[model samples]
Target: MGNWSMFTWCFCFAVTLIILIVELGGLQARFPLSWRNFPITYACYAALFCLSASIIYPTTYVQFLSHGRSRDHAIAATTFSCIACLAYATEVAWTRARPGEITGYMATVPGLLKVLETFVACVIFAFISNPYLYQHQPALEWCVAVYSICFILAAVAILLNLGDCTNMLPIPFPSFLSGLALLSVLFYATALVIWPLYQFNEKYGGQPRRSMDVSCSNRHTYYVCAWDRRLAVAILTAINLLAYVADLVYSARLVFVRV
Candidate 1:
């Protein structure tokens, strides 16, 4: 289905958000505040998040294909299928690895660095692409480029711990990464709509306006204002980077505790 189809996306978003709230919030309530407990909670949440994606992807794909759209749609269908297969492989690997059996924090450092680099790359790409994508609307171009760059830096800070790598701040990389991935999915989907909106505005010379619902006005527009199309791709890339960070952290945490 097209990016504008909120009906399909909403269900997935709501379910995942609820899962996050329960998993993260529950861990904070149940466990003592320590680095040891962090990994357990993260693993639980990551598994749940993956399970939810498994359900949503098949349902959404079937609904999308039912419309009998074009070749591009077919390509998208195939790409998503590959992603689903990859997710399943990850789930299998995670399941086979016994919990609390890995150790050593420094071992995961390289993977975390790679994720930080990826986030920086994505933000830079968005900044460079924004002007070309939304040249007709300077307001949108600036908003998207600025916000994307800012968020990317924020994510990098969170990843690298603001250059004080010695500080073992227990930020849950898996949880953050999953959240980032979900955010990326939203960004890319929105970009699909924004790209067309940008093109339409360019061809027609009309200022693009959004629907006036309060949530849409505040949250949706805020996200959409970030130049929509190119920014969306950047945001999605950031999310994937975040997910990678999470996986690295998870693996690293296991190493530290087990060894």
Candidate 2:
């Protein structure tokens, strides 16, 4: 089952990548393709869009649908975070490219499929970025709001000079949100992997395991500190900044190489 899950994930990732490249006009330049062929492209992309929607959005739905404590909610939040990363990575092609012209590197679609994906992706992000968003939590609210501000700034950057608008990176709103979400996923997952926790016996207390009856399998393990989540958020904040720089460097290379 593990092997099959990995295979399925790779398959989906490859399919999404192909759709992105096709939308970038990469294939057409080699084989003489055009927007005229978009019907077929759109159909394939839309199908994939539905598949993505089904897989990723469900985590968010489950996250917000009901409230639960214990390590379960932590697991759900982590799952949502992971899915967000995958969604954002797949979306980078569309986000990194500029929305211009009908075809070529400037063409910013893979169509409405992108728009639909973006909207759903955003909804998921709005919630995960602040799981307490509906609860009037100020700190988390501020964190999520910062993302919104960054997104608006990115959209503004695209509208202005736009740095050749064709050769430079055009970070739009969806792209902005997706980029941070992706980086956040990395940090959160890494922390979760390293987090140390041991089950305890309610009858005899905390820390040391009194009996073999209380195994790691019986109850979920949680991080020793809530501060781990804070640490993950901080690391991702650095990652988000680095990602923009990387995008610039990558765009510059593509222009020079004419790839």
Candidate 3:
């Protein structure tokens, strides 16, 4: 499991990055900017690009440069293939329902359903891409870098919300979007801070190791049995479930109001 985690991590991120790029390219014609729902749907591309290009690409580069081994690539590739299919489904739905009047608060629904897939990928990759976030870096440097990136991305997201862009305009949705963006950044940055401190703790080896296989209540997993890992896992899992729930609720609302 030395580089299996790192390899799988790189593979998943690469596949996701590829899928996102290809999907966006293909949708350029299908979901043109001239369409009324373009901005609404475009937010999905923004979020995925931020994660895959801005975040995942750098990590994959580091992983390959340092280890250059993709032992368990197939597993991670298969997982992302499923996510790619989900992404395609979202695109199909958008292609079928585009260029129409978005009744009530519905403009955000289709784009948001697609955006939810990216959020879910982030969580699912938490287990697959464990340790990559802080891989191949000194403790202080890792913390500082992640802190800076998360901070800057959060600020940018808030600024985007403040502008006349996306569904975060002219209503209560802006506040919700801002909170979501900041909270996401905070959670990601918090994990970075916690992992270093926890690794340096005198309890779990007292050294900053790459990865660990731990057991929690008979469930064996790759994350260390540390407070930071537990907290991050819980937060990511909660966010994933919440995003799915939001998608379902939005779909229901759109259908009910339309009916």
Candidate with best TM-score: 3
Clashing pairs in 2: none
**Segments of candidate 1 deviating more than 4 angstroms:** 1-135, 138-173, 200-259
Q: Can you give the TM-score per candidate against the true fold?
A: 0.29, 0.29, 0.31
For candidate 3, report its TM-score. Answer: 0.31
Better of 1 and 2 by lDDT: 1
| Per-residue accuracy of model 3 over 121-198 as CA lDDT, tens digit each | 444344424554345446534443443454344334333432435554464454544454445445555544565464
lDDT of 1 by residue, 127-246 (tens): 455465457666446545544644574355343532334245365654444444445445534544454454336455533443422323454311444344443454554554555455
Please write out the lDDT profile of model 2 over residues 69-168, one tens digit for every residue.
6346545544654564555545545443353334433233322222332333344353355353223434344555554554444433333322224234
If candidate 2 were superposed on the true structure by all CA atoms, what would the RMSD be?
Answer: 14.0
Query: Best lDDT goes to which candidate?
Result: 3
Residue 154 CA displacement from its true place in model 1, Å: 7.3
Query: Model 2: what TM-score?
Result: 0.29
Kindly report which residue stretches of model 3 are placed more than 4 angstroms away from their true locations once superposed.
Answer: 1-43, 51-107, 129-230
